[model samples]
Target: MTDTSRQFVLGKRPDGKPDRDTFELEKGDVPEPRHGEVLVRTCYLSVDPYMRGRMRDRDSYADPWDVGDRMGGHVVGEVVESEHDAWSVGEFVFGEGFWSEHSLLDGDDLTPVDPSLQNLSLPAYLGVLGMPGRTAYFGTLDVLEPDPGDTVAISGAAGAVGSTVGQIASLAGARVVGFAGSDEKVDYLEDDLGFDAGINYKTTENYRAALADAAPNGIDAYFDNVGGPISDAVFSQLNVDARVAICGQIALYNDEGVPTGPRKLPQLIAPRARVEGFLVGDYATRFEHANDRLREWVTNGDIEHRESIVEGFENAPDAFLGLFEGDNIGKQVVKVAEPSE
Candidate 1:
């Protein structure tokens, strides 16, 4: 192991969309684990849309990162040093880790990774079988609850969470319509993922018109990931007693101040639709169950997934910035290092 470790810290909070200047890379001595902690060498680091929220000085579901604080997120790594009874050197684990070559984590906070799991790579735990998967699971099964024959619409449908939600809803017998940024992604959703129809929002001038053509029965369930105009269009086409799962608002995440759009409440009133925003942490107790099911689906070919990986720990910030630009097809992850044999 190297004596020096590199990490990215918050250089400054952004006024609007963050750039390379927002991250400060620093090299320091590798940290040692105390009792009940393990030192992990990161293999894969997750870059997600929600991390943008942490850049702000204001409070939200997660605590804001102060200037100079290390940036952290879901990481898949292998233990290199251990001071904990449950973790041993060379074992793979997943947990919250900073954007660094190595990090110290409480053994209790880590989940052991089974490298031999069928049809899955280590990065899968950071995407489809990780937090994004759990978010799609609960948000679809509990919040959106699409019924058989229901027409379900998803915004940002080609992304990590939204993609998973579309598949699960299909498994539940719903006809799925997906809205993505490009025709290529739209094709991926329809041709590869079995979405009934796909609308490339970038090319389409009228969202409601495209939606009407795709979901002629009107939308019975909606899994919203990218809010804004797409959401406004989805609201206008809601069927009676529709359900909307308010997941992430990626479209408005980088806005400088409060963002205003068409009012959607009045549309919901006539439909008597139920809309609920949820955090995956709320279903923490059920994660193991969700992971097991997600694994089974992936293994059995019921669910298909993809990863857009940016190699190197140094590119972690760029991987994150790419999320807003729709540079990834599914999950965006940074490959830091390979697990040592």
Candidate 2:
């Protein structure tokens, strides 16, 4: 057993895009679990776009991380010590905990991982068969509700959730168009992911014109992941009775101040479109159902997934900072420590 754990803590709030100084790495004593608690050794740590919202000192969907406190997110870890009878050593579990080598977790906060549940690697539980996949499942099928032959467009389409949304929509028999940051990502969406078309938002000079050309019949379903000019283009291409699922706004996540963009409500009015912002946690009761489906989809070649992993717990901060830079193609996670055999 180790007494020291390396962790990152909030150092200062960012004015724009965050950097290494935004976090401070420190070594602290490993927390000892009391009654009804267990000590976990982290194997992976997820760094997501939503984490940026928590960095702010304002009221939002999630609480802000206090300065000097241990930064935490979705952590997949192994039970190394247990003070609770319900948990045993060497068991794999997922929970919200600090970005450290080890953490003390309450039994209620932990979800046991069934190694035989899916054929994907253990780390797959942190991505495709995990939160991002589940978000895509509900956002595309449940919220957007695209139909056969309909054109479905996704902003931030190369990203974790957006990629999954596109694949799911394609599976539902819709023509999928994706707006990504790079030509390489555009190729990934079209060539590798089976999307009908992909637009490189970064390289395109006339986004609206490009989108209009791609979906001449108009977009029947829109999954908004990057809310900015790219989103505006998608809004302009909406068809009658279109459903728009607001999954994320990563485009404006690192803005220095409140971003003022073109108002798009007028675009939706005549089209009679429905727009809703959704959180994956809202469907918590049905997570198992979603994961099971995602597992089957990935395992059977019906769906494909990718990950941008930053090796070592030491570089976790850099991995998190890279999200705003669009450095990753899919789900971004940090490999902290290898799980025990």
Q: List model 1 lDDT by residue over 133-225, tens digit each.
A: 999999999999888999999999999998999999999999999999998999999899999999999999999999999999999999999
* lDDT values, one for every candidate: 0.93, 0.87
**Tens-digit per-residue lDDT, 32-89, candidate 2:** 8999999999998988888888889899878898888788788888899999988999
Cα miss at 148, model 1 (Å)? 0.6
Candidate RMSDs in Å, in order, are 1.0, 1.5
lDDT accuracy of residue 56 in candidate 2: 90
| Every model's TM-score | 0.98, 0.96
Best by lDDT: 1
Residue-level lDDT for 50 in candidate 1:
87
Model 1 clashes, total count: 0
CA shift of 266, model 2, Å: 1.2
